[model samples]
Target: MPKKVDHDERRRHIAEAVLRVAGRDGLDGATLRDVAVEAGISLGSVQHYFRNKDEMLRYVVGYLGEQVTARIVAGMRDHAAPGPVRSFLLSMAAEMLPLDDRRRAERRAGQAFTARAVDVPELGEALRYGDRWLHGRVAELIGRGGRDGELRPELDAEREAVVLLAMIEGLATDILLGMRDPGEATETVRYHLDRLTPQGS
Candidate 1:
């Protein structure tokens, strides 16, 4: 009997290989041949999963977005208590920054895909979808924090959510640009979180 192939798993593997090739070479360099090489498979195998380069790029783009969303959902699972909410949020934000080589490579690949999406506006919609979902979650968290007395009484949850998202994205960009180290950038957010917490917290 022949071994059963997991087509979905194989597709995911190809998508990840695309990111690896994109990281090592620029996004444009992640050709089917390069991806096959990175994936340790034949070009025919990758082609079986992705019809062409555009389809591969789109797959990788959605894959990265799904990965980030999964992380966020996992991080939010256990951090429900008011006292731990802010710290938990910080940790979640940290996941977005590149603190290690693997994550840095992934981050670079994601940025490249996102940037390329500008020319293809439909591709950019995936990113915007993620942003909108994340922004809503953050705003809800901020509102919860206020009711719990973790945040200032007067802070506007929607406005602060936007600001926090901007800061987190900016800090992540700085890390990509080598303008800030991950540790310091993380601590900087911690400092701000401390200020946001009530005097006793």
Candidate 2:
């Protein structure tokens, strides 16, 4: 009898391998052959899962977005009250940083796809829509914070949402470049978060 293969598990393994190769070796090195080797599967098996490079790339893009969303939702669920608006904001923002190996690899893969998406319209659409969803979540959090008196009353939720997202992306970019420490960036973001709230309010 032959060993039964878990197709979904194999696909996930290939996706993870894609991340690793893209992270350590750059996107150009993450060829189908390389991913197949990294995933410990035959080239035919990989082809069986992904019809072509474009399909595989699309899947990887979705995988990274799903990973980030799942992390943010988990963090929100774990917090008893989601704490202050600043706390929720910080927690959600930290999901983008390369604070752990898994996140680091994801960040790398995300950056690679972002650059490639310039010429790939579908990938560009996915990124744009994903970013919009993220911004909506952040804006909602900001609105809640203002109502609870945990944030500055004069702060514009939509504008602050964009700013927060930019800051988080900048921090992640620096981390990916190895020019900034994740810990330091996290602290810096916290400082900015603090400034958004009044001492007594």
Candidate 3:
């Protein structure tokens, strides 16, 4: 009998290698040779997972988006009963920042790829679609909160959601650049949301 391949685990390891290469060497530094060496896999294996550099880059960005969205969804579920939605939102949003050493590495990798993707039209378009999808998902969640009286009725969910998302992304970048701490960034968002809450809601 042949050894059973753990395909999912293998894919995750490859994905992580992609992020690691980006973090350590910058986006352009993550060539096939580098990723294969870092991942401890054959170059052919790396190619098996990703057809090209652009494909790998796109994968990393999409994975990051999924991770951040999942964290937000979990936070919202955890804090659903709370009187105000701000805390939940902050908790969810904080997942995007370099709150710890591990997340810092991920943030670095993501920023590197984001910068490069701008010059690659196809990669940029894929990133744009994923970003738009995430924005819509978050906005819908906020709108749900408002309808349930957990958020201020006067708040504009679409615009507010975009602003909050942008703030989180910006703060994450700032944190990576040593301009601020993750906690301070979260506090800033909390302060903004507090002022937006309805009088009794």
The runs of at least 3 residues in candidate 1 whose Cα sits more than 4 Å from the true structure, single-residue gaps closed, are 81-83
Candidate 2, residues 12-114, lDDT tens digits: the string is 8899999999988778888889999998989998999998887888888888798789888887676537457788778887888888888888888888899
Local accuracy by lDDT, each model: 0.83, 0.86, 0.78
Q: Which stretches of candidate 2 lie over 4 Å from their true place?
A: 79-82
Give the per-residue lDDT of model 1 (tens digit) for 1-201.
Answer: 999999989989998888778877879889899889999999999998889888888888888888877888888887655566787779778887788776777788878878888897767887788889988998888888888887776778898889888888788889989899999889988887777777776
TM-score of each: 0.93, 0.93, 0.86
| Candidate 1, lDDT over the whole model | 0.83
**Model 3's TM-score against the true structure:** 0.86
Best-first order by lDDT: 2, 1, 3
Worst 10 residues of 3 by lDDT: 79-88
Output the TM-score of candidate 2. Answer: 0.93
**Candidate topping lDDT:** 2
